[model samples]
Target: MANIQFRLQSSTKEKKPISVRFKVGRKTDVTANTGFSINEKDWTETNLPKKNNDVNKLLHKSLLKLQSFLEDRYNEALTDSTVIDKFWLSNQINECFERVEKKDTGILANHIQFIIDNANTRKVSGRNQIGISKSRVKGYETFKKIIEDYQKTAIKKQIHFLDINKTFVDKFTNWLINTRNYSKNYSGKQLDNLKTVCLDAEKLEIKTNPYIKQIEGFAESNEERFIVTLSFDELEQIRTCNKITNDAHLNARKWILIGCEIGQRASDLLNITKEDIRYKGGRMYLDVIQRKTKKSVTIGIINPYVVDIMKNEFPYKVSTQKLNEHIKKVCEIAEINEKVEGKKLNPEAKKNKPETMRKIQNFYPKWELITTHSFRRSFASNYYKKIPTAVLIQITGHSKESLFLNYINQREDKDANADLFMQFYERLNKDKEPGMTVIRNAQ
Candidate 1:
């Protein structure tokens, strides 16, 4: 006889996921996530909801429903020689609940799920199995949820690749902007990810709309948003500020100085230890692979400020949250009070709501706007025109110069080579009379 049971994974006072256990006779027991959670206090020792409230009652009903459905499915599969395992149990659970479509279903949402599930097997440029990061997988999950919501509210049905067309794009973008409160940039990113998925689907011989080739997402121009950067003088102020009496602030100050000097992202910069540092040809460097892009970057310790800071002692390792908080306070003490035009993420924004439109955009003092991100931007901004663009990009570990320029919020001057052109013109004119026409013999 087959039996099903439910249990909580932890005794924590907070909500915890319900674990589903399936057993057949003997030695066939398996445990899986029920994809449902309940508050610890509301759970009974008998592996059931206490039914103290309507929500718990509903939770109890859902578990009972799953048990009934799974029993029926198992009985049906017995005659068909279906293997009973965690995968089969998971598929059954998903089919019983629309958490995702059945594994057999080939729809827009299903393809996204496939990508999310098989992200680890994904390769870049057909070689290394450099999978997408966990955050990226979470991003895809969020986008999938958004798609599911859009289907329920607007499409009123499942979205298929064939159903993706000009009409769909128009309706989707409108719903994202007007109904979902997403900014143009946020909406554009979602559509862009959709296009990438569509392209990936095509490679798999999946049916898709031909118009997807022409499909494009709309976003406000980059020129509209301000790129925050600290001036050399401002960085110096933060670096030399003596008012930092607290130990936390002192550690963060050292990190801020090193961050701006090396121009590395927070994850890469913070995880660096003394063992990662290398000496080559009388220079110090930190060799690391960028957490986001997976690119190998060797950051040279060229700045005298960072060198001096590291000379006495290396900064203590701290969480990114603590580092950001301490740096903001350090900036305030340094009197970086100049109001700057910028937009920042709203920590107080409602969960599951997009931080868009006017909620995040505003002018605030330079100190208030400064964050770990400002380190790289300030590094790029300060050294942009001073150093050769190519050399700077190499140091910044950017794959492309154009992307490097855009990252630094710099536009290349169109007439940058005008002086060279003028010199060439003068040399050409100096070799002959101004009005003379010279012709070379054909060889």
Candidate 2:
């Protein structure tokens, strides 16, 4: 049996809260507040509240109730084979009061609320900064709404942390794909977000479901749908197009060109200002600290078209949504209408449909496939052969060489390979080095 008792907390002041301290076998002792305060004079050596008056009687009753609650939890832990340590005891005490008071405790819905409430003002690690982006907070809210919807429609019960097992994960993924019509990648991201919450909960010593750590098959392959990037000729066509009439499309055209030249996300691209530009060593460059990665980069403005936009102070303040909408119009005006294959969510798929690589082979207008992100892809692809990859990664903020290569949809170009081979052959023949004897004999 566990040794459980209530005692007065030490305080320099006249009053202090009472706390429950317990010991199980030979383990280190544990203590937690009972959430009731009393004067030191009212706490006797027996650790019982004095029952001299109505207020004292109420305090005594509350303390007795707390003791009974702890005893019951300790006995329950022994029967269930749960380790009766400080972490377990503390969580038990919290749960007990929450039950008595009819308050939501550490359930999934309440944990999500805690995350949403503190989403902003949460510190960024390795820096003294506070608060995350508003968009990120909105993402948390969206996740909470999805969970709430699932509870209302399917589960018909409150979700607990222990409910996040393999079965729960599979059901949630199916719901997102079939009921919510979320794309595979988007659904995977939502599951990733839930896993992130579970990790945070574990840090708080919450007893999490084991399946949260062991679940598999959440990642989707990128090979099925080809990454679309604008070619140099396509970019030139958009730049030379003279038919843009709307102000928004004209502004979006300039922003797309800027994104293509700078190789940054639309979040960072649309926030550029005159103050961000600097002239160094007889050349102009944009000095930017990326919003997402929080990394600094210096991009030289070598393109004459981009230089003109900076010189004329063209508006770079368009919202990302407007830019995505208007850029397609601009690309359409440029006649970039070639069909490209990509993935789209199937709206007609029924619930419980087994997840498969559902690649539709229908052709989409090139402009239809174009998004604000295409600008960054176009920049990476067009300049990948012209510049060293290391230098390009420094400007594009790609942390890995392989990731950058994949981002540009790097593939074997037969003509490019032939040109490279010919250059190598000429170098070997012209130099006439010792190792070139075999090559010369073959020629």
> In candidate 2, what residue range of length 10 has the lowest lDDT sum?
350-359
Clashing pairs in 2: none
Candidate 1 TM-score versus the reference: 0.67
lDDT of 1 by residue, 36-131 (tens): 899888888888999899999999999999999889878875754556777668757776776754564447889999999998878754446568
Please provide, for model 2 over 1-443, each residue's C-alpha lDDT reduced to its tens digit, 9 standing for 90 to 100.
Answer: 76778878788878897888887667648887767789988878888888988999988887777678788766755554454556566656656565423234456767777777886777765677887777777888878877787888865555666657766788788887887666676788788878877877777888787777865435455575467778889888998999987888888888878888899988888888988898878788899998877899999998888998987857758778788889989999999999888654343443544343243446788897788888888888889867767788998999977788767767634465467678768987896756633444554
Model 2: lDDT of residue 208: 81
Number of the top-ranking candidate, with lDDT as the measure: 1
- Which pairs of residues collide in model 1? none
RMSD of each: 15.1, 9.3
Mark the 10 consecutive residues where model 1 has the least summed lDDT.
Answer: 350-359
Give candidate 2's whole-model lDDT. 0.76
